[model samples]
Target: MTFNAVTFTVFLVLIAVVTVMGFVASRWRRAKQADRLDEWALGGRTFGPFVTWFLLGGDLYSAYTLIAVPAAIFSMGAFGFYAVPNAIVLYALGFLFLPKLVSLAHKKGYVTLTDFVNDRFGSKALSLAITITGLLATLPYLALQLVGLEVVFGALGIGGSGSWFVRDLPLLIAFGVLAAYTYSAGLRAPALIAFVKDGLTYLVVIAAVIWVPIKLGGFGEIFRKGGAALAGKTTSTLDPAIAVNPSVYLTLALGSGMAFFLYPHAITGVFASRGAKTVRRNMSVLPIYTVLLGFVALLGMMALAMGVKPHDGNPQYAVPQLLSAVFPPWLTGVAYAAIAMSALVPAAIMAIAAGNLVSRNLYRQYRTKPVSAKSETLVSKVVSVLVKVGALVFVLTLDAKFALNFQLLGGIWILQTLPTVLFGLFTKRFADRRALLAGLLVSVVYGTWAAYQVKSATGGPFGGSTAKPFFLDSPIYIAISALALNFAVVVLGSVLARALGAHPRAAGVAEEPVAASN
Candidate 1:
């Protein structure tokens, strides 16, 4: 099918308008001091409830959610439902948990989760480890966002021709715009653009929900046709862990529930709120998006009706392909643009968050002296560009399937930090810094090894998925399991350290703020 050139043009015009709006965001929240890193990176920590809600939603749903959920359903059938529940669980957990994190952040003037890690563990090295791990994990996450944008462009016929260079033009342009505003306005850009992105995303999601059914007969019909084929043809269904294992499901739900906010970029959104109250209020309301997610996940079922298969070269293309077939050229163009916009906001946030880690944690650690605020800010901006470039390499070199799976692998890797970042927020129980380090190392190896063991098809003991269950057969989130191992090691190590009389740091660090929102 062909695109509605006129509609596509109008969509581009709207995105460009929003892009410029983001560029002016710094001025919107400008304080008297132009050079303040706090204002630049944390949006002056002054966003009210509405902005915080949209910003957090935009950050969370993102291009990944927009594209990946439906793609999962299109490719993997019932397994794809995990993403929808994961999102709901995340929002629900945030509602119950975020206010405290936000309160502590506000009180402490914290700009990143690493700050909290440093304060809680009272260990610079552990914080530095978190900082590095977060940057590494998020870089590919940023690349996946770009891949989302590229899929939309390829679907909508946005570029000159179908060549790789042409298809990728939108990604390059999106990256440039994101980098420019993020450099100039920092968190303000994403904070402001969140409104546009969330607004468009909500509208597009609702429209697709309504339109897809009408276009494809109905939801029941679509599901009936699709579910039957999927049940038999899928790689494996017997292994509960790999397919629907209860333990795997519960672990994934709980692990992601715990780790979602622990992600540096995710916490960055919380840090930008005006106060803890705003976070709590927003949390109460954000579950409304869970409704949208239900609809969004259904798009996968719709894709099945349309016979949307993962492209040989690009798994990311499934959603866009499904949408293009289900909608008129014009509406499809709008949907693609909306998804592209979704990619831009989160990519910018991840890049900035990652850059901040490098500049503040790693670079400053090695420097002769503390870097000036201006230098800190400048270094962040420079590395943001470099990080984006590195992500571009991932996009170019890795197959889309490999990239997506590897990203999930990265999540498993980063989840190791949950104990140090999230649990450490409330108490100092496992007070040994060395224990934290050991836990982190254990988590990394265990999670990666588990992911390596998972296979596409289920079979003999060794032949099954990377997460070869000493027990189950399902798509248990590898990252979540890794986190458990990380925490367990920390517990064992702390026990040993205490018994061995390893001198504790003497309550050695500056006191951590007692609240999540400062």
Candidate 2:
């Protein structure tokens, strides 16, 4: 791959522009109480529908969605189409559930889902479970974003050569700039950057849809050529052959939809909305991005049609290579910058969400005395930086290919919170908080162990998220199986606890705000 100096310069200028914009965003809305948790972490929860739309879209569709979705299609064919349907299903579920959750969080002054858990259940044990699971799940998700950034860096020919630190220097510097603004401006940084991130995304996707097919002689030729190359590959493109296990595909799609909003960062987006109606309105139109994702996935087929061979046989490079083949150097740089910035929006959200979880859920608990609002915000800022650093280290150490499963694996851990997050939304007393806590514990361990036992086509453990438990004839999504076990424990364990007279930590959910006084 040849490096273009103009393209690199354009990309650098874009990054610098966004970095300055991120810093300026702390003053965008110019709140009176800037250091308070609500202002810093939730952007004062005043974002209107227009801003909320971009923010949610930016946070939801990360670089992983842009990079890995197409990469999977390039390598795995029809199976990777899961990213599209699952996104559609996710919005439908979110439209139904998110307004209510956001309302509860907003009404109760909850910064993190763990705050809601503490208020609703009155149990630190349950809150701890939610917070730990969220952080653990989020780290890999953050790592996947870095993986996306690295992919763009490599495509742009700036994946520097030499030792480990030297090679990732570009990525590290970008992340460093991201961290500085995020720390200074908090959620507002990403909120402001989202407009740029999403605008470029639409332009790049639309351009690729028109330009790639035109370069390859149109969609008809693309399909004809791509289909021929993908022919007789049962798991190939256009075959609709997901895998040998039909049930597995259905379960995987359904589970992916269900687990999408349970991630803490997702809930953070909901919490950041102006009101429940803002969320409802955004979900109504959020599928615009979903449609965009569909076209982006087709870039894989265009790659095949153009005969754009990947670097080092790694198909993750297919889309980047495709861009270089079809588009001018400047446009390719724009496309790469769009993809790279996609990581920043979601990565920032994830870190801020984790920072909230730790500062409020974890750090607040251990304090011998009450924590000050300024201290809380400071701690959150520090934690956000550490989270990014941890993700940077993770992507640097592990095989980038492993990141394809990061979202799935993260789902396995995050899905255990469903009984608490999704269920707690409707009713307060579905089961004992203790039973729910126990259920979470059981599901996280079981789901991970189950997923770990399943071997990939390459014969390694943690190969995938689909597993065949003894109760099923075919492999099903491990998250679904683990969720079933969670509900079972909640039901039976609650009954047993009731029989033994072990009561809940609180009888009814608290009405007062859970956040500490400012």
Query: What CA root-mean-square deviation does each model show from the true structure?
Result: 3.3, 3.2
lDDT of 2 by residue, 141-260 (tens): 988899888888888887658887888899889889889999999888999999999999999999999887767788999888887766634442212432636777678878888887
TM-score of each: 0.90, 0.94
For all candidates, the clash counts are 31, 0
The candidate 1 region of ten consecutive residues with least summed lDDT is 456-465
Query: Residue 50 deviation, candidate 2, in Å?
Result: 0.7
* Candidate 1 lDDT by residue in tens digits, 1-518: 24567657867887888788888886896987656667777777888898888888888888888787776676667776776667767777777667877787777666777877776667777877888778767876888887787677666666636787775676777777888888888888888888887888788888888887887788888898778756655454245445556656666666666667767788888888888789878878888887887788788778777777655534467778777777776676677778877888888888878877777677765798867888887887888888888888788677665566666666776778867755565554545777888889878887767765654343322232235334445455566656667778877877888788766563222454475433
lDDT of 2 at 358: 91
